[model samples]
Target chain A: MRFRRWILPGILVIALAITGVWGYNQYKIKKNYETTMQNSYQRMFYDLKDHVENVQVSLSKVLLADSQEQNVILLSQIMQQAYLAEEKLAQLPISHKDTAKTEKFLNQVSDYSYALASNVLEGSPMDQDQKDALLKLQNYTDYLSQELMGVHNKLTEGVFNIGEIKRKEKEDIENANDNMLNVRLVKLEDKMTKSPELIYDGPFSDQVLSGKAKGLGDKKVDIEEAKKIAQEFTGAENTESIEVIEEGEQMDKTAWIPSYTFSIPKESSPEDSPIYIGVSKTGGKVVWMENSRAVNKPKISVEQAIEKGQKYLVEKGYESMESNYSLQYDGLVLINFAYKQNDVTIYTDLIKVKVALDTGDIVGMDAAQYLKAHHDRNIRQPELTQSEARGKVKTDFDVDSARLAIIPKEGAKEYLCYEFKGTYQGGDFIVYVDAITGKEVKILKIIKDENGTLTF
Target chain B: MKKAVLILSMAMLVTLSATGYYLYINNQNQNNFSSTTEGINSVEVSNAEKNKDGVEESETVNATLAPKVLYWGSTGQDVKDVQWKLAQWDYYNGAVDGIYGTETYRAVRAFQSKNGLGVDGVVGPETAAALGLNFGPVDGGTQGAGTTAISRNDDIYLLARAVHAEARGEPYIGKVAVAAVILNRVENPSFPNTIASVIYQPLAFTAVADGQINLSPDADSLKAARDAINGWDPTYGCRYYWNPATSTSKWIWSRQVVIKYGKHWFGN
Candidate 1:
């Protein structure tokens, strides 16, 4: 009797203890779930807001393009993004009726924006009415973006306690360590220094530093080592002397980077181990360095690269020749050439590249490669007379002007062509025709409708 | 015998009391959980409503609702097919994914921008979108989902095309937006405008910023195009649109709202 009594008491105590533990665990689980859910929702909201911002940016581009083609393409893209953003927002399943209503409003805004773009591209006539509508649409989208920004800020500040729906989610946090926003811009004062046509100007040069590189490692440049390496490459005094002008960071927390400026002899070339060496400041190791490959004998000069580009085309039989127009992109030179064949004048662009003046080596050639790779193409000469070609223009089009020029065709031939531009059929049209054969070669049409006016 | 019975009854009473306590706590927890879930749903709904309030004014502003039907190109047939194709790519924003709506127009523009097409936002020949290629025609098993279908290589090509289309005709910023538009379409439902679909829409993007979509896209273009598509978007909610030159589009005035970015305005 005593044993039975004791066993029953013990069982009662155990059961109570188990219940208490279970209750605590449940509380903890619920709390955890709430946190995760809240976080995920907030992030999703921010993502949606960001997407809306992107749509505004795209539409802005359409408004700014100068070419008819650019405007059309940009308009199309704006409409696409606007609707997509609306759909994304709609999928959130936010239970608040007010929020759903707001989403619907945004959707309507997107629809309006898309409609304008479509009408404009369709050659619809543009009047003050359309302009006024576009202005309103533009303003509304901006307001929406601003409003969303406000919401995002509030969420970030914990203004809304979405604690019940909290849940953990994997996030792709941008590693703050991977920033090199301290790069600076410097002019290459020395002619012998040889600046590359394509410069790797890091984000730092533009002052677009977001300070996102928290806990980032120092720049990946070994100042002392890079100076030493630079001396060897430039044949400077002491073969290790370098003046550090600036320092920077790159690839997150991995390295320290620095930029140096110096004056080397005019005869210095990339013939040595390295003319210039970029090193990692953190580890005092080299990350990048240039070698002697850029240096060659009188193998190719800037002028020679241009000549070669032209000659390459000539070898393929393109005649009516001229010269390179100008140089750009640091070391890139644009060559303009003309040739006459079969009573026609052909104009073409030839691009030539010289890595550095100090090395006199050709680094790239374009026009020649293009001509060689693409053989003379067969083309059907237009058969319409100038009058007939002009007649093909719509009646509403008004003739602005006309010109006669020699045009080059792909078959190593030239043709006398007439270029006519006018407003026809209530739209602008630019037409090209063969003067000798009186055939229509090309036609560009620009339409003006309620949506807007297009210019070619 | 009486004392033993008393002890047994007392034990039974204790057991009953403990069981009752356990049940009470369990019921309380369930109630809390259900209440919290309801609260979460309510919160989400409220937040969404708050988000949409800003664009409410523009829809009724000029309100010149035109015919919804669109003539995408000369024959209109290409636009129809392209719209359906875009639907497959998940860019369809309307009923058939084929019926061109305001959303479809936006997606077409984004595609043009990605493929170096003209910024006219139309699916004209010069803005020839990319043509779908059969990788299998050259090598079997070389292309598949997540493997060859619009992979990094294609991204680069599309990016280059966007650069050509947007940057060539407009300022560099416009080109970036053009790039962003393509990227936006990749995430939007109104466009057949997957990063790949919009790019390969076939003659839909001819004036790629370079006035030639025929230019072989470079690796940088592909990557940038993809990045723009995946990264920062410029057309999130904006549906109606206009460039400054075409600011006179009456349809735009019909839209009372405005969302500004860089140099253009997007909204109804």
Candidate 2:
């Protein structure tokens, strides 16, 4: 009887010890994870502060420098630093709403600096208005740097905890607002909204961002018209019941092409996943369409799918679209078709068609790029012959074929070039030489494997 | 005396037969050893030649002769040929000096690894054939079959995982909208430029924080990712998306909701 009593007590004590150890280990693991997360956030915050300071310093140097070379170098530095700062800021644990204006300021600064650097390289100095803009931008960056440094100081002094802020942000928004870092960042963003409206030849320019869809015609289409267009685009035989899911007014009026979205069930099985199609409001053109039905094993080849896609495009009245690079994945083939105008391929006007390899059916199509960029272009005879343009390519590059093409550059600029496809040192490359100036405009490396071909 | 002589002759006959049997077995073993080595050499030669035939369209008489296997410490014209090929392919930086030294060995190993051959730093029949060197017979195994073809791009795979984790319970269009939002973030200057950076940005995605982004995606999620990449923007360039019922941030509510798909609301 005495031994039994001792045995029960011993077992209870051992069980309690095991439970205590397990609880401590769980606590340690959680603590370690929190520490690691905190460390990464702290590192990103410090790097962001550094990049902002560099950008400010570089902007100041550009304003004081008189020599074109020095100014160009300083402006390039500002551009790079600003982009890096933007990248770092995006990586931080902050909401996009709190950093929208700040991010826009950084983007504009980078783009403007790039434009100014290119101008200086092309033998033009910074004009007075440009100098004033740079000075204004420098003042903003200075303020931003000061605010960032203040936050940094607080973080270093333990007045603000990034980990605590993350926890509170997820649990209590009011508590997160009390964090000094969040308060300073919000103030900094408010100040950033007052930055100057920059008008220049760059992508982030207000003029470019506000541009409308060029390919949409002027005639407005009603809901009924749009539904009919969707049915026709998706093939009337396959579409059973079409319903207007969204209207043009529902989307962002400025950023997106105004369109009417329709969901149509398949004729074969109306209960299955339906096909979604978007028809533009102005021209009643099909903006995009997708049928997400699961595809089975592939029975057709890539070439056959390309042919089917081309035929589908022609049936939809998209003529003269030449097949370009294709990617194959998940029993489907997505082919890009560029509009061929007057024997010169217009790369900006791109259309992608996804064909299911199982049934040779055109399952999806996106014409957003084409609708954004397609327009009539004046055909011009090349000043230099193809052979002369070919001379601009590297001598060692083994040229296989050459053709005329129009390629897009930065900020709405397009160039007419002689496109050459060839191999250099056993790797495929595409060289674009300006047909008029005979300058090598661009070089693209083509990466090919069993999956598909891609260009970089 | 006659019986003793008979027993001695019988013993002599047994000894002669045993000696003959031993000689026959020894000669057979020697032949077998030689033939086995020859068999291995022929197999290697044939494998190399098959690869050469796949790479080069025209057959040359030089391929008919067995070529010497080059490795570290090898010298002469064969090493020079390998060095020249590697240099042309930008895999080698050393001088093409007729001698296979440490540099040549490293280059050979790198080439072998990239071409999916045995990475021994030795230019055996397979490596030689991959280099388009004229060596060995012309008909054997399929060439380039050892190189694995990637089925999907890494970005696509990552995007699919994110979609699966975040929108697996939503409709097909909603899943596509989630992927579109990720792609739109990549394009927006306010966010990072790469798909990975945008997806992995600190606390930007709930799936990543909850350890769900590591989950394998279903086929639907992969199709959705590809659809988004193909420019099927169901959300129409909206950069922010959230399930209002689950989202805790008051800031997300401040943004104007542009479109609603399934359980999520998309906004700028």
Candidate 3:
């Protein structure tokens, strides 16, 4: 009896001790992880500060430099430092809201410097206006660098815990605005917003940043008209009801095509699966449509699916569309159809159609690219014949076929080229040669597997 | 004699308790260490569980050292793996019958020669790497539910995992919208240029930070990713999205909210 009593108390004591040890260990582990994460964030912030300082210094040096070669070197340094700074800022834990304009400033600085350097390299002297822009950019970067230094000082002094701020923000977002780092960053953004509007021959130039849709015509369509278009696009017989869900009013007026979004419930579709269609408000044309109904096992072949998609596109008034690439996944085959004009394929005006392999029905369509870039192109006669362009390709390419095509390039440019498709070392490749200059323009390797074919 | 017996039993119980405690502490320490890193340890845990089914521990070590070479007479799952990979590439016309016969040997030789490897019929390290089969002990096997014929590095597969992790509970349109946001960021000059770069940027995506991006995507998420890649901008080029109720950052509220789909508020 004495031993039994002692055994019960002994077991109770051991259980209590175990619980205490486990809880303490867990706490210690959590603390260690938080410290490691905090150290990482600190390191990222310091690197960002250093890069911004380097950009500021380089911008000043570029302004003082006279020789074209010296200016190019300094500008390139500025571009590299600005891009690195932007990348570091993005990796920080700060909210994007506090860093939007700051990030944009860095990107514009990089792009503008790159464009200026290219101009210099091409033997074009820097004009007075470009010099003034560089001076203004330097001033902005100077201010940014100083502000970042202030934040760095506060961080080093442990004015506030960065990790604690992140945790508190997640727990209470409204109260997170009081964080010193966020306040300083917000102030920096305000200053950046006042920076000069930069326009240049670059991808991030103001004009290219606010690109307009060339194909969305200027004819106003009301909600009723848009609903009708959506219903017709989704097949009026299969639609039970269509409701206006949202409008694209929040998009920047110059950058995006405004549209009326609608959700239509199909009569025979599964629960929670509805057909969504976006009709451009300018014209009654359907911008995009998707039916998310689950498709059964594939019964139709990929070729049959492609044929069905082409028929659907024709029925919907997409004429002269030539099917190009097709990829299959999860009981669906997505086919890309590009516009063809006078025996030349226009890759810019593209449409994608997703056909259900189970029933060969058109399940999805995206005409956004078509609606953005489609227009009547002025066909130009090729300076080089098909055989001449084929000669530009490597002799070992083993070319199987060649055709005329127009492909897109950077900075909103398009190149008319003769596309050559063939095999090389058991791999399929598409080579594009400029029809005018016969210069090799671009190369794409086609990767094929049981899933589908894709270009890399 | 009775007292002696009781004392002996008591000593045994104490020893048992001490050993149990020591083991519990060791397991906890390992778990703690692994949790510091993300995504990889979950696979290790599953692998450890799989080893309980009478698999010799030494075999696992061997598998880890190097994948087995399949010769003419090799049979079992490894042979089946070679057959499947060869057939997918149209090198092998024989059945995937888990037997390395004359047809399999010829296919291996052809593949080796075509890929600039030594013209040997044996399926060795170089051949397996070319075929994209690691056969690591942790991977368990080549055939599994999540192991599709599609390359893991494929853009669609990566995007599908992101979509599934970020918006598994969202409606189909919402899933597409999430993918569209990622794509829009890729196009924007302020962000990284590549899809993988943008998705894996530090603290850029909650799914990647939380290790959920390693999960296998369902069919709907895969379809959503494909639709987004095909140029369907359901969010109309919005580059940011967040759940309003759960969003931690106060700065996201300052963004111009473009659309609300399911629980996410997409913004520019």
Q: Please report how far candidate 1 places residue A229 from its true position, in Å.
A: 99
lDDT of 2 by residue, A336-386 (tens): 888999889888888898899999999888888888888888968999999
Model 3, position A381, has a per-residue lDDT of: 88
Instruction: Give Cα distance to truth, residue A61, candidate 3, Å.
Output: 4.0
lDDT of 3 by residue, B97-160 (tens): 9899999999999999999988889877657667655432222245433222323234566688
Docking class of 3: incorrect
Residue A261, model 3: lDDT of: 83
Q: For model 2, which pairs clash?
A: none
Chain B TM-score per candidate, please.
0.34, 0.45, 0.48
Using lDDT as the yardstick, the better of models 1 and 3 is 3
Highest DockQ model number: 3
| All models, RMSD in angstroms | 29.2, 21.0, 10.6
- Global lDDT of each candidate: 0.41, 0.75, 0.74
**Shift in Å, residue A349, candidate 1:** 56
Per-candidate clashes come to 166, 0, 0
Interface RMSD of each: 25.0, 26.2, 12.6
Interface RMSD of 1: 25.0
lDDT of 2 by residue, B1-268 (tens): 5456555655555554455445444444334323322322232112111110001111111213333588789887668768877886778999988899999999998999999988999987668768755333323444342222211244466688799999988989999999999988876666665566677665678777656775666657867886886678988778888887999877788766677788898877
